[model samples]
Target: MTRRDYYEILGISRSATPEEIKKTYRQLALKYHPDRNPGDKEAEAHFKEAAEAYEVLRDPNKKRIYDQYGHEGLHGAGFEGFNNFDDIFSSFSDIFGEMFGFSPGRRSGRRRPSKGADLRYDATITLEDAAAGTELDLDIPRTETCEGCTGTGAEPGSSPERCSACGGKGQVYRSQGFFTISTTCPQCRGTGQYISNPCTTCKGSGKIVREKRLKVKIPPGVDTGATMRLTGEGEAGELGGPPGDLYVLIQVRPHDTFVRQGDNLYVEIPISFVQAALGTTIKVPSLNGEVDLEIKPGTQPNQVYTIKDQGIKHLRGGGKGALTVGIRVQIPTKLTREQEQLLRSFAETVKDTVKGSGKQKRNFFKGF
Candidate 1:
């Protein structure tokens, strides 16, 4: 029987890249795999067809010849389609591993140990702590190796025995028409070992959920959204596998008196109108502590003053940011009659001086 075009079979164009071709083949193979669609002859045939196309297109030399002379040319070069399921699986073990996460040939034995899942913990800190760095003890919840079974899941005096269903192998093979397919052994769950007497503590799971207290030191300049990774601090692995990592996500609490932008801090300090016009030294809040700031004469409302090295530390490099203080001039809401009269007299004198100069400043508080 004449075969379909390789590109057409894989549902790809002739100009498809190698990665695109492999991706297409992987999808098709996974969709029509016999293990997934048991007792379906049409799906098995599609799986074989995809495997054959992938086999030729994955090899550079075979692809070059097939591109030049087509399937007829591939036949002339001694290219034969897969003879059986084993042939197809053996030829595409790597691709199958990418699809099923393990080599297909190893299905007949114990599955390889896989790393445990990584975990995440959210950590909150004050803005001051973020600026100066702090040490904290965190209570983390995770899975740890069981003490009763020592990670084996078997009782103290009893050990796991070989699975009888798969004859100590991890997988069981079944004959379906012209194909022999292997699947994970249900009795042992692919471990090839069965616990006769389950561990009382972990109940044959090999892991226990417990809370662990860990001391963590947060470096200075760590901002919100920064992450710290602690290796080997996640869930315990299975079957002698390595433990995963723990990620701590930082969340900096909002400051009551300051706002941070990158490494800079902004603050608004209220000063009396008399102090603003006459200049004075006042204390302002900073991440470090209270610091004295000098207000120059003629300091206007909303005017800004900067204090160097008083803000948040740089997260990446050296030096710190500046603390910008915005001036807010306070206007007295209540005054005695005598005080009001005195202010009115002062305003009249200032108006006369401006009139004598024959000049007026724009928006110079004419009402005041």
Candidate 2:
């Protein structure tokens, strides 16, 4: 049988970190899981290949041997690839535990108190606000535990009854050929209990939807797609569990004059060709204010200069980054008659000077 390089199989470089390998494998598994692909043979093959690569690379010893000696090293140590889909499933019985809900393995013989779902809020702010940092009130709509029955889904006086189908285990286990599959109990919907007398406020769901005003602090230098987590601000947890978090997705509006890279700000300052020949000082725009920048004599176009402490503040409390200014020497698009005549005279003078010096002619305009 032929085998592909494990790194290539997983679409990762050989220098990929362990966390990177795991994250990539999780993505590939979700995309090619047998359940998701149904009857696609190619998808199943890819799924198996990714799983095999992950299994070897995750183990330090196996990876070391495989890196030193190719696939033959594993075969020499009595390790062959999975024989079939059943073999792969048997090896990783609860592989989808953290991924899909198929084999959640989330239940713990009793109702588990899992954290509530995390919420996301998209916020658009001005670039100035991102550079200097600002605070904003975000209205987050989420679920809160019903106060009437204290999240029991029962009326004030009455309580829920244990589910008879699952015997309060919250799941039903059944044999599927060589595998035992666990699914949510249909009678209780994984809640482990049935509410005979439902709460009037939450309507037997044990939670109520409400909008909350949360004040979130936006840190300085936060770029677009930056996610800030507000702890314990998500939906109320199930049963007696802790609440999840709220992630704020920040999007900074584009600046009119500056482009930012990391903490550095880039701005192009257009100067006349005369200034390029004889250097001059100009006021450059920065996040703070206008700063004087000195241009050197015979400065080339697109020459970059750095203005210290004029960029965005550090996300964490540190000094500001630099503002980089690129010089753009603008040539005259249309020349006046006198200006054209003067330029032609200058060129002729330089050509005559070169010939008189008994030197070979060279392109002198390149210096400008």
Candidate 3:
């Protein structure tokens, strides 16, 4: 079968730079990798096609020849001889490991002892508590270092022995084709030691699951999705390694009256039609307490009034944010017969005054 253009196979332009070409190849390779799309023949074919294209285009001399006369120009040019599929696969595997934050060089020697996995705990606090900053005691269930045998995982009065599988080197070598690769010993898991008589308390795991109470101090201005890290508060490590970290993910409860944006607080205050028409000082709720706000005469609906420094405190350091009160003018929907009659009379008098005022008439005409 005739092969497609290398650039077209990788979905890149002929003039694409080297960096752009490599990026496109990586994306396609990741999407069609055999491990990711297991048992899919079409995906595997596409993956091989993209890999072949990358192998040719990545080299400057081969790319120049291919660009000049296409693939046929490079016929019998030893391009296939220079390309090693194993090397390409290894390079792409390293790219994936770095992207996903996994162990690098999976088959290279004994892997570094795996760190204890990070632990996450959800902490829910009220908006007020978040604004003021509060301390909380959390009861967490997690794996801790075993007190029995001091985390040795060996039976009392006995000790673990060096693993015979890897001869205490913690790694085993294997020959694939002509290449020799070293990998961790499956028996001892690269620890180089094994407990002959396992500890009954921890069952040779060197750790036990227990409930612990931790005190956490939450700073002010912490919103939902905020995360705080506590050092060395996570799971116990294996074979005397360092413990992992604990992450406290914050979840702020919704407030009854206020919505927070960063440090700013927003709230909608309803004002009667009479209060909006006539200027008055009314008390409004704030983070600190109730504060009086002056509503100007002839205030329109959705007008915002800002109170300085009355919002949430800054999470880092420095000044607080402003509290914005959005005024919502409420028009009365229900009224008594007497109130309806009075309102109608008031409306008629206002119309008569507008007709009598020359300035009001000119202003109305100007708007038109």
Candidate 4:
């Protein structure tokens, strides 16, 4: 039988771009693939026909020759079409690799498989939440295989077909002067298959974007920039592949009353100068509650007091961290006349006591 026109076989115009040619062939191949349409002789013939058309149109030399002299020119170049399924698959092994993850071969048979993509989310928590573990419900938006189409990208009761252009390999090759170069088949877009009856939901993409709610348990002692991994909780996988993982990155907001370093909590407590001078028991704030902290007599400003077992909880262990309290003595900014008189009197006593001592370095201008 006389061969059909290459452009007509792929359903493309004479001015069709290379990409258009490839895309059209992919659609044809998928519709007539042997695997998809088993026991159908007509489908097999169509598969071979698409592959032949793709082989010629994909190569510049063959395409130019066929365009000038049609199939007669290819006969002169001694180009015989593929003889068997093995020959077709072998010629397009690299193309199949792009369509599937692996190349087609006798030992490595084709299988329906896919692997999900990982996802990340950022969460901000208060210091209290970090000290005590908390549970949260997060709504994660991601792409997953369509439930309606079951990731096939085809309408219900329908199926994807082998790419006719690339013969289900999803790629094409052309011989150069000395080297053979392989490229992605424009027809199938490198999927090695095509969906003629596309699923309306996913628009033939096989995946959908939706939000899913997941419960996340945040561990205690998780600080800023800490990462929590949730296995098998990421975006859903394609086809029958396993689901990916979800990563929750923690961002701890600064606290108004406390600063944390490792397992220690640092807080500054203000005390009146009188209290610092006379010693007193004051209330200190901790993660759990308030506790009594003792201020020694004549305590200086910026002195640190450590309270054991009162800070943040250990992330991985049993013991709690220490609470460090720094004393900030406040001098009276505005004093009453009586208070001023008392302070002046106290200063005089200090001066007199120093004068009474044997130290004789006092200058005469000191009294003035």
Candidate 5:
């Protein structure tokens, strides 16, 4: 081990930031590389020094210990520097591989198990079904693990071979100016495995697209924009991971009779002005059925009345909402000769009720 300071080897300030240290190390490594000065032992020594300095400073843990207690602290912590050129190249393959134009080997853990993507299903249900809870069978098209090859993408009793293009790393490297760019291998398409003998059922893919029939239960009082999640019902996973979820979005269709807001139901009932003036009992439409509602005398237009427990049911709690009925009083547009005589006789009994305008009073007695 060299007795010189790590920062001094990389030609950076002692209080330099991590980025500054890395930049200085990159310049030193590029300048004193053995490839540029093949026969110069001094340049080889400088490259080793820069690599060692970078290997220490790039790591926060080792850098902290070194910053606090120096090289002896790193030694006590069991951090021996690179032994040979192979070690330096292998350790910095991610950095140097990108700096130069060589493919970095499979060091990233990209081959681990990955969960499948989630799926969405849009369903429109009648408002009655939404209020009363119903069960439905849905036809869904999705990919599942192939039964022929058991998700291996190969013929039965045969295994997939390692990708030759990417050497099972699933990535290909190409020299682009001063950087090496990595991309998915065209031959293997990032699977890192090649299927020479493919399964006849699903071609070479590890999954198959098929329509699945599933029965789902919808709770009462589910409105539009409500979402339900079904776990493990989505596309099949890759590398033996768990399957994803299926999201069911529900849209409740509009009703012709009732307008729903939250748990309440509203309906307008039109009554004649005669009925509005005199108390009467009438049948009102509700979620359950026709129920009787009483209208008091002199009931004004647009007046609202509530019928208890006649609206939509609660989703979680066990109860029902009230039904709101709005009164709409209709006046007679035309009257017969006998009807006008009867109205004129009635106006004489209640003359004080007809004193709004002079024109209206004149019109009331104009026929008489």
Candidate 6:
């Protein structure tokens, strides 16, 4: 029987673009995957058909040949067979190998040592410490190189011996039709060497857990979520590999008087009703020290005042940001009889003189 068209199997048009072809194939493959549709013969057949379609359509040259001859011109093209389930598995292995830097066909006898794992630690600092920058001494517990046997994992004078199971070839070959695949040797565990006598301190492992102290200098203007990296400060590598790095994540403590926005500082200051009406000079807290700020007379509530060069320093080498002070007028919650009378008298004097006063006829008509 003649096979169906590759594009028809993937539910895509013949003129479909490369992206459309891949998207359709991926959707069909995921829907009919053997793992997702267990023991379903129809789904498995559809999955195989989708994979075969993608293999041809993904390549422009192969797609052209298939389009011209409809699988007849592609006959005896020396393409590997996929008649069995193992053949399908081998095809998947080749696709994944090309994508992730691992192939089942290529293997050397020797195994390369792997690097140590990276370490992460949280570092919390006060807002003051963040502004001024400070040095922090941290004690971190991690794996370090074993001193016994000098990290060789051998007992005193004894040494490791070559693995006899795989003939020191860390990998073993398995035959699959016309192809040979290499897999890590189970007996040697890909090390190609075995330790007859292990070190008592590390027990064949080249590292041990220990506490280490590190001094880190935090730069000024580093806010929360900033990370500082220390090279080669993580766990020691095994079998002479390179050590990993240490990451210090910064966490800034909340401040009572200041709210930071980028490099700028925002602060709310309370001023009396008299100070808001009749200008006054008030002391405001700055990063350096307290500074006198002039409150203009007749200042409205929630009016913002900017003091230049009084904020935190810019993190990216720019000049300092301005300190914005938002003034809030405080009204008396409770007043004595004498104070109430005085405020009443003052309110009556300026009642009709203001622009919004109902009695001011001229100001009201001026807008019209």
- Give the per-residue lDDT of model 5 (tens digit) for 92-146: 7666656754334424313556788899999999888999999878898988889
lDDT of 6 by residue, 1-368 (tens): 77888888988898999989877876786677565687999998888877888878888987888888767766756543267654554566544323222233333535776688899999999888888789999999999888897777888789878888867777766666533456678887877777899999999876789999999999888899999999999988867788889999999988999998777889999999999999999999988889999999999999999999887777778688889999999999998989977776776687644433354787668889
Better of 1 and 4 by TM-score: 1
Each model's TM-score? 0.71, 0.61, 0.64, 0.66, 0.67, 0.68
Candidate whose TM-score is highest: 1
What candidate 3 gets wrong by more than 4 Å, as runs, is 1-114, 174-183, 352-368
- For each candidate, the alpha-carbon lDDT, in order, equals 0.87, 0.84, 0.80, 0.81, 0.84, 0.80
List model 4 lDDT by residue over 165-195, tens digit each.
Answer: 8777665666555334557678877677878
The deviation in Å at residue 135 for candidate 2 is: 1.7
How far residue 24's Cα lies from its native spot in candidate 3, in Å, is 20
Candidate 3 per-residue lDDT, tens place, 16-54, comes to 999998899878977886656778999978888888788
lDDT per residue, candidate 2, 286-328, as tens digits?
8778899999999998999999888888887789889999999
Candidate 3: how large is its RMSD?
12.5
Candidate number with the higher TM-score (4 or 5):
5
TM for candidate 2 is: 0.61
Q: How accurate is candidate 2 locally (lDDT)?
A: 0.84
Global Cα lDDT for candidate 5: 0.84
lDDT (C-alpha) at residue 39 in model 6 = 94
Write down the worst ten-residue block by lDDT for model 6: 96-105
Candidate 3 versus the native: TM-score? 0.64
Off by over 4 Å in 1: 1-11, 14-109, 352-368
Backbone clash tally (model 5): 0
